[model samples]
Target chain A: MFSPLIDELINALRILPGVGPKSAQRMALHLLERDKPGAAKLASSLQQAIEHVGRCKLCRTLTEQDICATCTNPQRDSRLLCVVETPADVLAIEQAGNYSGRYFVLLGHLSPIDGIGPEDIGIDVLLERLQNEHIEELILATNPTIEGEATAHYLAEQAKRLEVRVSRIAHGVPLGGELEYIDGGTLAHAFNSRQGL
Target chain B: MFSPLIDELINALRILPGVGPKSAQRMALHLLERDKPGAAKLASSLQQAIEHVGRCKLCRTLTEQDICATCTNPQRDSRLLCVVETPADVLAIEQAGNYSGRYFVLLGHLSPIDGIGPEDIGIDVLLERLQNEHIEELILATNPTIEGEATAHYLAEQAKRLEVRVSRIAHGVPLGGELEYIDGGTLAHAFNSRQGL
Candidate 1:
């Protein structure tokens, strides 16, 4: 076993996604032995972000200020709001640079078995925005997983009740994907959802 | 793009091994969204370990004190020293639980192309130990790479000059390894080094 503090560092690093005990150990040793300056900077940055960054009051994406940059930007189309499941999803959409709209981060999707509901994912906050804002469309951009589909369906019902246009992001074989190599389920879904020319 | 602080955190986290842009974003979001307390603890633990931990004087392994625990342990065999390339190697040997000898970490191996030689890896410090201490046997436990082999050969010559016995870690097929699956180089070594038993 390593010294207590080194062991603690390794254990703490294990909490990161995809990091097991061996990777954590390697990370700790690499930091301590090879990259002390980088490690120090990482620690300070983590502390600062954790201490200051909170949910944007409007979109619920993480930010140091009340509203996130994307939500507050005048260039983005406020009337065409895209709702996503996490801040990372917001980033993904932003990086694509195709969407010129604001966002509403659910922070999670409905998972009844795990006891997470609409309330748990801040649906009430989203509803309040829908009630007040002149949003022309409510885009459902959640994942293609079962829970994500359920979430999109639930949100579509809500958007219909409010008479707002609602659409799910396209799901099929990925761009550049070979049809022959595509999974059966995805291929079937693509065939079923074949678009009119 | 994320807020300044969150973006900084993601960028800082990318310095870790195997963490690319996507993984960094995922980690930053995961910590902020699902595990704020865990993130805080990790930050504090990182800061504390970096601030407190330093290389042990005797063996050059990471420790808060001057001498590492293994070098100070009374139960370990001081007369039989195992030399390794890094602190991780020390842990690997310790986990095997069969070696009772103390360790001396080289932190690196000889690489003339990289301008790293005996002095750079603290071979001079190792020489001091070999000269001052009554170590009867020195075991070369460095990695089996070319640089590691060069380092082991260099250390072997030094130990021989000091009238100390030296041996390299065994090479060839691993325990429980199927002969058919073993590589040609390892199979050849195993055949050449076959014992009387």
Candidate 2:
């Protein structure tokens, strides 16, 4: 019922995750009503990021530069490498704040049905980086899913051949989660990594 | 915890309606993951709309032209004018698919407390348009809220003094709404306009 321009705007807004027709209409109305500058800013930023950002050549993380800021930062420990399945995973690990190391971003997890393999998702590039950077340890920080596990295992074997120590992140109960409600996999992990209190 | 760029992206995403911190982060990650072009589309549309859209001088409705399409349409019954509180209200009435009249957008409802008055929301312009366009019937299609009611009443009185016929839309139980749960005011209206079975 709206003009074609408004319809195009609504369609553009619906591209966001979880935004449906009604939500898109509401957002478009709001942009038209209260926030012209904010809307303009968002559009400009989206265009700029989409046009400019690409995978960091070294780590495959999303970045404006060929080498991401993380890769170029001298203060970050280059010897400890955290391997993750996606750029988002890198951000999540970074948010948790315990690791002071660098990252290796795989575009996707190992999904056999999808024809994704180690070589397809920059694992070769990671190995090359590890060899060139003299990385002392590699941490498998991919999710605890089956594909993540397989990817980690494959990377661990590869790292071993290169004489680099390989380890996986511990997964048990999340922070503040009750032990009584913990799942079987988590309980098993906690048990396997048992240490003296 | 992530890069300043990611933080900026997340903060920008939060400007969308119902997008909290978690949802903002999720959207930011989603853009970083699978839908860079989609995100770019949203941003580009936002900027384009912001740059392109301006209020119609005649109706105060959002439009790319000095006059909105609704106001400019020669075939629409110029003598039958509908008054609404905002441009969105105009769209809502248009979507109902029954109104074939031109519109006057108030830009906002009457709010004396916020110092919003007749002149503040282009009441004079509406009057001038009504006279200039030779409108005979004015439909008070503002919302049902207290402010909306006040504005409608005020405009209705003005239209009466101007010798233009004024009519308020009938309100009763909405379609698919339970009549038993309808408020007294609406029930009274329904009774007053009761049709013969």
Candidate 3:
């Protein structure tokens, strides 16, 4: 074992996702041995981000300001709001370069067993936006899982009362995916949601 | 894409070993979103390590004090000195729980092409220890690679002049490693170094 500080650094590094004890040790030693300047930069960056970054008031996406860039951008379509599970999903949709709409990040799905519910994921704020804002279409871009489906259905029902059109993202064999390799659930969903040419 | 601060944080996270851009983004967001306290801890730990940790004066291993605990411990055998390429290797040998001798960290192996000479890896200090410290034996625990072998051979030649016994760690099929899965080079080395048991 190394000194106390080295061990502490290793333990602290394990807080990051997917890093194990061995990896933490390697990282600690690497920074100490070779990249002290990089380590210092990373430390300052983390401190600055933690001190400044907060959830956007509009869409609940993470940002340094009260409202995220995506929510405040004039070029983005205000009349269309896409709902997603996390901020990372918003990045994915943005990177796809097809959506011009604003986003409403749920942060997580409705899992009753885990005690995650409508209010927990800021569904009230979403409903308030639906009633107040002139959002014409609400796109459900949550993952194609049972919990995602349930959350989407619940949000759709809520949006319906507010007269906002709701649509779920299509589920099928992924682009370039062979049908033979596709799972039964996705294949069945694709068949059920098939549209005529 | 996220804000400038978020982007900076993500880029900074990439300095850690094995973290690519995607993983860096994930780590950045993960720390910002779910574990700000953990992030703070990591940042502070990194800062503390960089500020306080320095090489051991005797063994050249990283430690806060002038001498590392291993080098300072009186229980360890002073007459036997194990020379290794890096401090991490010292930790590895210590974890094996067999070594009770002092250590001399080379920090890196000898490489003429890269312009790394004997002095670069503290060969002069090692020779001084062999001469003045009454070291009876020198264990060359450097890696089994070409560079490691070159370094060991160089150190062995030096120690021979000082009248200190020199030995390299065994190179063969590792414990629990099947012969079929072992590489040809290692297998060949194992055959060449076969013991008379």
Say which candidate scores most in lDDT.
3
RMSD of 1: 1.5
Model 3, A127-195: lDDT tens digits are 999998899999999988899999999999999998899999988889999999998988998999889
**Separate DockQ for every predicted complex:** 0.85, 0.50, 0.91
User: Candidate 3, TM-score vs. the true structure?
Assistant: 0.99
CA lDDT, every model vs. true structure: 0.91, 0.83, 0.94
| Least accurate 10 contiguous residues by lDDT in model 2 chain B | B1-10
Which candidate, 1 or 2, has the higher lDDT? 1
lDDT of 2 at B141: 84
Candidate 2 Cα errors over 4 Å, as ranges: A178-197, B1-6, B179-197
lDDT of 2 by residue, B109-155 (tens): 89999999999988888877766768989999889999999999999
The full ranking of all candidates by lDDT, starting with the best, is: 3, 1, 2
Q: What's model 3's lDDT at B29?
A: 85
- As for DockQ, the candidate ahead, 1 or 3, is 3
- Quote model 2's iRMS: 2.0
Question: Which pairs, if any, clash in model 1?
Answer: none
For candidate 3, give the lDDT of residue B115: 100
Local accuracy of candidate 3 as per-residue lDDT tens digits, B1-197: 89989999999989999999999999998998899999999999999999999999999999998899988899999999999998889989989999899999999999999999999999998888787888989999999999999999999999998889999999899999999999999999999988888
What lDDT score is found at residue A179 in candidate 3? 95
